[model samples]
Target: MHLKNALQKYPRLIVRALVHPTGIFQQIRQERAGTVLAYGLVIVLFNLIMTVLAAVSGLTPELMLPMAIASVLTVCIGIFWLHLFVYGLGGRNGVGTTCRVAVVGLTPTALLGWIPGVALVGFLWSVLLLYLGLQELQDLSKARAVLALVLVFGLPLLLLALLAAAPGFSVAWASPGRVTWV
Candidate 1:
């Protein structure tokens, strides 16, 4: 009876919780997407500038190395953002949220020595947050809510990790010479 009343009163609560200002907080609580985009864009732009520098400087590899490093870092950041956007966060807050999530999620990739590990952690964190947000909308019990969060967020991350870590798994995209390792 209480459940029925709650559902009738909050008919659109679930939808509201997945969109706009009401849900925006849940969608973008961490600001991860923004950070990743900023870092990635700066790195890519810097690399483009350096490529021009290399050309004007007579095509020296030495001159290109720094730019190359910067570009690689940027791409890593972008990848992190992508991971978070796709796997960690889930909602219907529109394209702005989506883009922000994508960019921010990628920022961790820029760090050295712990790229994969950090990315994995970020991914997990994102999933957990998303799960919690969804559970809040569903009004489930604490234990069941946590379980729901795990199932909703965990399976996708597991699949993505597998794909990423798999041998011969490749995603091709074009970038400036400095951005491409091979």
Candidate 2:
């Protein structure tokens, strides 16, 4: 589907995905990979713009490029793990199909990311979408799908926490009363 159509359908699709995920998954499965990629690219660009805006608002230059790259890479890696988890959970959807679901599921967050204080909303919404997507696309029990998402997202977050606590490491943006240390 085109971006306009996708945007127009966002609210309805979110409701449908939550209420009847199988139908949503079927719709996502039928999406062309190129269209999904286009949608994803828009997210990446929007993320970059947000990063730049943050920099303008006093975020350090040293963190700018890395943040931009990381923002995009996070989405790419998220898609990869999404596909892996679906397969591991015995879903027969191909990689492209999984990617499409992820892209569409994340669409709201991706589009609204520029607004301050909205990232959390987008994130929570995307999590719900992913949870539903896994259950519907994989034909999995809710518990199993939740476990899959935990592995896909939780592990990395836990790892990052451990690594952050280790040695002298600190996330630059997280410095107390400072925009960055570097």
What TM-score fits each model?
0.27, 0.71
Please provide, for model 2 over 21-59, each residue's C-alpha lDDT reduced to its tens digit, 9 standing for 90 to 100.
557767766666675576567666776777677767875
Query: For model 2, what is the error of residue 119's alpha carbon versus the real structure, in angstroms, after optimal superposition?
Result: 0.9
Worst 10 residues of 1 by lDDT: 107-116
lDDT of 1: 0.44
In candidate 2, which residue ranges exceed 4 Å CA deviation? 1-24, 50-66, 167-182
Please report the candidate that would top TM-score against the real structure.
2
Model 1 lDDT tens row, 95-122: 4444443333232222221232343564
Colliding pairs, model 2: none
Worst-scoring 10-residue span by lDDT in model 2: 173-182
RMSD for each of the candidates = 14.8, 4.4
